[model samples]
Target: MNTRCLVVCLAICAGPTFAQHIDIDPRKDVANLTGEQIYTQVCQGCHMPDAKGAVGAGRYPPLAGDVKLASGAYPAVMVMNGRGNMPAFGPMFTDAQIADVINYVRTHFGNAYTDSLEPDDVKVFRPPPPSNPPEKH
Candidate 1:
């Protein structure tokens, strides 16, 4: 096959894969951005622009007034560590960023939960330190 023809064929074959791919920004500084901005740029791809979630090959639960969000801790952990099909974003965002996004989701999309999370609150959910060998009692 000629190089030109091979390149064309590869492009045709790769088109669908690119179309189905969702781009999530890998930037680490989300603290300065508003919750809506973070959601629009990052979460919108999966959770959707409306924050209603989606279903197809996989299920994404809606964030609109979800009872699970009544506790800020639930969403904070999910955002930080990820759950099910969601990717872990803990390393990609600061505590303040995670808290801001969680707070946004909790308060928006018909969700009326009044609680707001702080960086300390998110820190508490982090995996605990490894325990030392128990001393003989």
Candidate 2:
């Protein structure tokens, strides 16, 4: 057999094995994480380790020295509902987690806004459940 054919055959055979080894649970609860922990685990992936944000295929507005974070509610609403290219994290994170991450970002990365957000504040921004439930066939 040609080397090209052998490589393709090996890849096809190994793909399922590699996939099966991945044990990530998308719904894993993160309710207990601290503000910093939540930011590191979730927000840093896009916003970056330094929280300076990034720009490429999409722009992640820099969290550092951002004037918008002067209003705690603004970041809270953005995290819960998302805007433009950002995805809504309301479904994945609890209200507390959302509040924590927002607070973390607001206070860190050269941002010094001091009014902290409580989980109650974040709860208000969460979208209400759908009025009509989808029926499962």
lDDT (C-alpha, whole model) for all candidates: 0.71, 0.73
Worst 10 residues of 1 by lDDT: 22-31
Q: Write the per-residue lDDT of candidate 2 for residues 10-39, one digit (tens) a residue.
A: 333355453234432333324466789767
The RMSD of every model to the true structure, in order and in angstroms, is 10.4, 9.8
**What are the per-residue Cα lDDT tens digits for candidate 1 across 63-122?**
886899999989988987888767676765678878888998888999998879999999
Whole-model alpha-carbon lDDT for candidate 2: 0.73
